[model samples]
Target: MQDRMTPAERLAAVLMGQKPDRVPVNPFILGFAAKIVNLPIGDLYADPRKSFRAQLLCAEMYGYDATPMYAYASFGAWEFGGEVGMPYEPGQSAPYIIRHPVESPEDVDKLEVPDPRKAGSIPIAMEIAKLCYENKMPVVFQAGEVLTTAANIAEPARLLRWMIRAPDVVHKLNKKVAEFFIAVAEYFTSTFGADKCMAFTGGPVESNKLINPRQFGEFVFPYMKQIHSKVLGMGVHVILEHPCSDQNANLPYYVQLRKELGWNGKYIWAFGPETPLEKQIECFGEHDIIMGNVDPPSFQFKSFEDVLALCKDNIERGIKNPSGYILGVGCELPPLAPPINVYALMKAAREYGRYQ
Candidate 1:
């Protein structure tokens, strides 16, 4: 699509609270981008060459306003002693966690902050960051956040148990996890620029659905706040990914997080389809960036028409915000998401998402 600004320029303008030609659309296609080129998703991840090319190809195919880097799942865990073993299969878009590093509460104490430069996927991810900078692809990466990384490194059950029975142990582990991601945030901001880098986490982050506000206050808040302060200080933007559903119950905590963090709303917060459109619009629409919320997994079952209709509904709801919005699937697209459905998404975005 022709634009008054380059994709990078449009992203920058919108982020600075200026109008771009239209709202940005960056679905989290990740390894699914490889499928469009018929490469095994495994190689696309492990091999930098394939991963880079596939990411660019997918952006071109979909005409996304910005591209995404897959600093995906377990890269931090593997570096900090988790066993990462899902070899990408032809049909598989992502590797799975064969083994996690920490099995018990005590294991969390043994965790060390790996050197960000030498850590698990940091080298590959660094290479990806370099490529993006050189090519000027406006992009974002998902490194592990403190709370999620704690769960990743240690079993969630064990981590949560410690949060209740032994809160000190949980804090100790979170400190290490926060340190690792803070280094990662610094790396990206230093390599590229703050405007070009976004640090994202929170599929299960302190969601009221998973834990109570008191638990959030006790266990999750401090570490996450530390991580947020450090990363934002390093000049990178931070995104607290889908803080949890049941906004009535959980949204206010997120609201408090933004205000307390003094974001005055520079930070971005994403929400999933499970979150109500009105609530997101009311809470985040005017104050902060909201990237999000089309469901990727449901694409396969729905017809192209249905998917487009849903995208129409989703975009219409999202664009009401003055803070700016990016249309996207909240997380990675399912591996087998149909090409037609993917096309429908891009088409729907362009047709329905144009600015007035």
Candidate 2:
């Protein structure tokens, strides 16, 4: 079955709640893109121009159906006056926080919200957004999830301990992070016009594997609701929420947050493989688009056939979703993943993800 629509058309159709000729493939590729273009992975995070160019090249080569965008998991550290080390080595995929800003409770009180346009990676991200706008693609921006960004600033261990020992301090830090993300939402939407921007963020630190449901409810849910609600209220139509790992236990809270925000049919939830695809659909299939659950490491360590098999299974299941589905990796496409294995996603979309 030949594709009846271009990649953009296919995605547009899905966004509008209509079926296209086939499922769109948007594997959560990032550092892997730099590798494909023979650039060091560090360039993907440290240099916005290089990152966007590599991503565009890789997407064209793979014939995938997603626009190039920039973000790293360790988002808050550098933006809030901490330091980060870029991915300079072969195995390193993203910049890591080298120095956390809030080393003590006093630091949290002293923390100030930096200008979104000039702070840490926001400048880099703005450059990418400009390129995307120039190229007539959606201008995407990262709006940090409250807990994850706060954890980055305070250091995860200290943040978690603070949740128990100094609950007030934790809330204060989260409040500040929320302020930063709200400011980011305001800046991006104002710069690009909310109608033209897509806001995205993930919750790796708030994953159920590390924190239980009660903790997520207490620490993660309220702030996330505030940030996303503000983003949507600002006229940003779509938000991509990637709950990065084992968040099955946290699904109810997410569903509740989505409801309170009234983001029905205007959100995309991309789950990590640790959260079953069935569960994702069960939670959000009535309205939002469901993407992912493909194991990222399989693209690096498994055979092409095995990778395709995984894609096939996900597509078969996800295609049944009422809202829509996209073929994608649960997390960042590993930098070392074989090109053939990455291509397997597109192949699976073509072979088994057809609508007619």
Candidate 3:
């Protein structure tokens, strides 16, 4: 059972289209890292030094095969001049927007791309990115998808209403959000060199549970096209797209977007649990690296054996992915997830995910 390669080596092999000794367990660990180091979830975001430390410490503790990364669901509010409420309570996992910057249609015209170097969590995130770079790891940046970030800047319900009543305003806001995303990419490219950087994005707002496929085409596709095209143009190594939750109805549009942008193998699609692995592989083909779909809530609520069963099933299919496969949690690991259950993911991978 002894490994033939280190975690870094295994990850590099996959990234380079080479076979590894086994499937790598890249847990989408966030606040869980803080828990490992005995820091409150709030410090995980408010203090870059501590955040970076916690992530590394937790990864070392679990012996996982991925580098530390910084990201949060509520990404845009503070960056675009709104207030954010950092999580300080026991069960709270991520920060939330206390006040959205845009309250009305008029505010959309007032939007401007904030300077990435000094903007909200960018500075804090940059601190972690630099730490990763200095330690010879990929400089990770969470340059979120356009529609989701725009929703954070305004509000989700407001954007939904606007999508029906005032489509023009939604487009205007998305344009500005796209610009901000591009600007952040530019900054990361300049600071860390494009080869050393990795962009992380997620699409929770565009989930079928939130909007239908038509809404995705109308509001999500165009700006996502622009963001992906421009960010890839910056020559970053890869963009990890986490299409979170119930996106089966909108999966084809994602394939279409990739086709339209000519991004054949430029993305790493980490899907949520609601999307089956068979469907994900069918949609993405043998071009992109497929990362995940393990139901994350199980870590907090289920037994270790139950968690192991899920990981085993995911690996059985995911290991056959022609392009590549990474064993990862579907979403961020819940802060309150039992330690033994979290360990089940790695245990299952080691037992059943070994490459022939």
Tell me the spans in candidate 2 whose CA falls farther than 4 Å from its real position: none
User: Which residue pairs collide, candidate 1?
Assistant: none
Query: What is the C-alpha lDDT profile of model 2 across 1-356, one tens digit per residue?
Result: 46778888988899999998889999999988988999998998889889999999998998898898988999999999999999997678889989998999999999998988888999989999999999988888898778899999999999999999999999999998999999988998888899889989896898987899999999988888888888888988888889988888898998898778765438888889988888888888889999867998899999999999999999999998899999988988888888999889988999999996
lDDT of 3 at 71: 84
Model 3, 202-303: lDDT tens digits are 968988989999999988888888878887888886889998888888898989987887754457889898888888888775678899779988889999
Weakest ten-residue segment in model 1 by summed lDDT? 240-249
Report the CA-based lDDT of candidate 2 relative to the real structure: 0.89
Clashes of 3: 0
> How much lDDT does each candidate structure score?
0.71, 0.89, 0.87
The best candidate in terms of lDDT: 2
Task: Decide which is better by lDDT, 1 or 2.
Answer: 2
* Candidate 1 lDDT, 183-239, residue by residue in tens: 777777877877677776664645656678787766666666776777677666546
For each predicted model, how many residue pairs clash, with residues at least 3 apart or on different chains?
Answer: 0, 0, 0
The TM-score of predicted model 2 comes to: 0.98
Model 3: how far is 74 from its true place, Å? 0.9
Cα miss at 275, model 3 (Å)?
0.7
Poorest 10 consecutive residues of model 2 by lDDT?
258-267
